[model samples]
Target: MFITIEGIEGCGKSTLMEKLANSLRSAGRTVIMAREPGGTSLGDRLRAIFLDSTLRIEPWAEAMLVNTSRAQLLKEVIRPALERREDIVCDRFTDSTIAYQGYGRGLALGPLEQLCDLATAGLRPDLTLFLDISVAFSRARVVGRANRQDRMDSQSDAYHERVREGYRSIAQGNPQRVKTLDGSLGASELLQAALVEISVATQ
Candidate 1:
């Protein structure tokens, strides 16, 4: 299964994906954990550039850069892992581009969707977990972060709100493949909920 987790920055995507990967491993599944704008040598470099808070990237440029990384990650990591019958859990996928660049950045969704399809070669996640949180919660969590904030994390509250809404819209549009989870839940609860959803989906 190619499982992707999506949400606004600081919505606990990393924590949830880690727990899911560990759970899958405990069940004797070969799991590959990946993050978008990453998961390969070239992707990591692009990730650094994308998150360099000092740099200014236009919306379309940001979209293309991420797709470039995605193309590399698919060729080097995700597609091969799937070929080996391993379960892959990714922190973000093509949907992030649609939400961030299309909705949040105010780009055309049609072009963004086409770009994603081209970049990924029609690949889509078998399951997508959308962690839903309010803009207020996101702002509080991002502001409380102890580490250096990435460019996405440093976006304005309104931008984060649009991204969050974008995620919700995506979930609504893909009811069978996308599951919405409350980001305010406890860690254990969230993990269990995700497990249940995975169980149902894969059954």
Candidate 2:
């Protein structure tokens, strides 16, 4: 199963993903942890360019680069592991393109979705956990971080607000497959919720 974690910046996708991966590993499931625009040799280079704040990338161009990385990662890492019956935990996937490029960057959703389908060869997550959080709170978490801001993280609060709304809309549109979670919850609660949801879905 391809399980993805999605959200606006600093919504705890990465941190929670680590714990999720650990939990899955403890259960003796073969797991592959994939970070999008990464998890492959070509993707590593693309990630550097994609996340460089100094680079000015048009929305369409940004989407293309991201999908390119995704295509490579899927080919090199995700697909191979899945063939081995490994459960893949992806940090981000197609939904990020829809939210960031479509809503936040003002691209047409229909065309972008089509483009995504082409990029991914129609691969979809079996279960998606969307970490829902307020734009203000999510932005503050990004600002408070010691790490340098990436291009996406450095986006305007207004832009992030649109992205956040886009994620909610996606979750609403696909409630059965995409579970919306309150990102503001404590770590224990979040983990418990995740475990329960995963259990129900995978069972």
**Best-fitting candidate, measured by lDDT?**
1
RMSD of 2: 0.9
Counting clashing residue pairs in each candidate, in order, gives 0, 0
Task: Tell how far residue 110 is off in model 2, in angstroms.
Answer: 1.4
Clashing pairs in 1: none
Taking the tens digit of each residue's C-alpha lDDT, what string does model 2 give over 120-172?
A: 89999999999899988887899899999898888888999899989989998
lDDT of 1 by residue, 1-203 (tens): 99999998878999999998999999999999999988899999999999999999999999999999999999999999999999999999998999999889999999899999999999999999999988888878888989988888888888988888898889999999999999888888999999999999989
